[model samples]
Target: MALGHRARAVIGSIAAAAALGALLTGCSTSSDEPAEAAEQAVEVDPALRAMLPGELLAESTRITVGTESGYPPFEYTNEAGRIVGFEIDLFDAASDRLGLKYTFHDMLFDSLLGELYASNVDVIAAAMSDTAERQADYDFVDYYNDSDAIMVPAGNPEGIKNLKDLCGRTVAVLTGSTQEEALAGLNAAECQDKPVEVVQFDTDADALAHVQEGKADAELTQWSTGAYNAKQVGSGDIFEVANTEIINPTPLGFVFLKGDVELVRAYQAAVQSIIDDGTYAEILKKHDLSAGAIEKATINNQPQG
Candidate 1:
């Protein structure tokens, strides 16, 4: 981990979404619901607190968490450089349920798993997909549904509407992301002769910049991220999601090391606690991201017993 290159962002304002909600995918929020609901105090359960690892049981021990920002409506840095988003809010709510304290460490998306494996971060809060490839080595408490979208310049000059449209066209992707993997698979299986030219960047902002500057014809990212950028950046004149349809909506979660059963189960309970208390729904509703809301918390898609 590059200690010198990271910013420790104390994620705040989980419910301060009036401005944030306006820059979304046109989902409606309850104007009548006061922000006070989000600010409501969480009563920590002693049973759940007792389930935490001994090292984490201390009041002073802060769980080091890694997150890759720049994907808005999920995780991103504000103008003041504070990390705030739906994922941060969801996890914060979960932390409160478990009576745990944790801080978010923002870094390159590529370095998040590395930092987690190196013990520099105890968990990853980024909206990471719980793919079979990753589940082989990590246990993830599934929290939300995630899908990808194809974002192109406004008016979509390239006429890119779907994956087949990317043949021979340039697409910018965040390195180590599912989007990058999708491009690789496309090149190998479908676009061999005129392979889609893939440009990799370290963050979502950089990848989107490739399209904003006309370097790449399109950018592949989370559906919510693409939608938010389409609406917010350049006052809604910069980008547009070519594919309005959802693709491969998979469960995403807070990632933990494989065999870390206690930690994984503890979080599963925490997430369930929030779901039961309505905080989970409120967070998603505030962000207009209820499309990805889950009914129950799971680990790798299996209901926790």
Candidate 2:
């Protein structure tokens, strides 16, 4: 919770973003174009491919994935409207180990689960964490280790540095994120006398906008994402990550439907293969996220038990 590792990751991210933004200034791409995962020379693992369901293989095993690209450094649309991030890189590695093809569909984070339930997609690889509550409807292929964080305007203007400082202040959060649930709980239990105002939005973009516009005092999101947005907006001029203990350090994974045991097994083995071969590590380092890399591939990762 000290954020010793995550904070470093954020700083590295800002340096990279600043460089990228400079070169792409004045250029634009149609937002309608979805960013595809990076195509790399990943050798296919025949053994893992055989573990996949026969029905899945029948269609050439091109897995359809749902994601919320509004979150940066992990999964977000770049200046070219191309989907690029560590999550995409991880999936690219997993697909290689599994010898499969994958596609990404960007949508509201709240609707990702629904799309999976409706059979519109085969997986959700949006840096989603595997929680006990989520386990009721989904299984997961754990890929990254991360935590929650808060973002406030630069220069410590409001002096909201820690969890306690959030009391009586308005904090914007994504509508269905763990941060929203966690912050509300904090309000009810710890800030009863002066509860924090929890403003909800369906998109990370909207939640971030609320804080930048001065309508909210702060925004709660994934630590790396908060850090990414801070440097991304104005090259470190817009916001700064609060100096608080990392909030909910947890595993972020590829969410799968509960009944797809075969598909789940395929991914678990594929993920382990990448971890063993160093492909996973390389991607993490490329995105300045090596600090959150997990040493093992796990399924349905819930730290509680």
Candidate 3:
């Protein structure tokens, strides 16, 4: 399963859902309003204020980052129980560039944002897609552009070559992911008058396992996740990448609390500096993920719907 293929399979069904309710949401209210309204609305404690951006990185020597640590080559714990991956490296590089100390906390991918809102962490360096809907809840620093792909058993035994081919086949996806959103629409249409089932898992590994066990016909996921799984499975011939599509090619970036403009600026500067100095490319290559890197962009302050 090539990275592109797995992303396609997972995204195919997800695109169907978007077609049902896919409308771009905006994030701007007024330029004069404080950018921290969302965090203030949540009433984060005073003690946590120091942890927010612009208060001085020295005040808190260690910053905490949250990630799922299950999506390999992006964020995953190694045999030593230390989180390591492309996102992890990016954070490490940023921390080093900023002379800031940090720690990594592994949690559910969907829960990472909630933890940030709760003031549990200072940043989220997971491979989070920067969508307008997500921007409404958090600030993002765009760093990469990722597209969806599909993954199937080698030779695509079911001839599951594309989303249209999945009309009567089972598909696996991670629960709570945008990929699931795509699948919802496909399932409604493709399985509307049939027995097709869309199975969901907490992680890509679990979803891929279901496919390996013959419990499902294929798994859909991010390009990187699909590629990593294919490599781990150790048989390019055993799995096939099919129908690559940019169904959800979103800017991937590090997430921060809504009002942390200073921290976001610092991260943006660090990311840009890395990109300029060639350090960013080195990190991506180190992880065999050079193709995923993208140019740095100003933080999009508008809300996403």
**How would you encode candidate 3's per-residue C-alpha lDDT over 1-305 as one tens digit per residue?**
01111110111133422332312111111112222111111221233333334334343345656677778888776665556677777766665566555555556666677767766566777788777878887889887777777889877778776676766778898877877877777767665766347898877778888888898898878888777767777765556666566556777889887776667767777767677778788778877888877665557633323
The stretch of ten residues in a row with the least summed lDDT in candidate 3 is 1-10
What TM-score does candidate 1 reach?
Answer: 0.86
Q: Per-residue CA lDDT of candidate 1, range 1-305, in tens?
A: 12212322222333422322322222221112221235656678889888876656777556667787777888876665567788878877788778877666667788778766655567888889899998887789999988999999899887888887898999999999988898899999889999999999988998999898889999889898888888999889878999866776788999987766777888999999888888888888988889888989999888867
lDDT of 2 by residue, 50-144 (tens): 99766555533345667878777877776666777888777777776776666566677887787677565577878787788888988898988
Arrange candidates by TM-score, descending: 1, 2, 3
Name the top lDDT candidate.
1
Predicted model with the maximum TM-score: 1
> How well does each candidate superpose onto the true structure, as a TM-score?
0.86, 0.84, 0.76
lDDT per model vs. reference: 0.77, 0.74, 0.65
Where is the poorest 10-residue window by lDDT in model 1? Answer: 26-35
Which order, best to worst by lDDT?
Answer: 1, 2, 3
Q: Which clashing pairs does model 1 show?
A: none
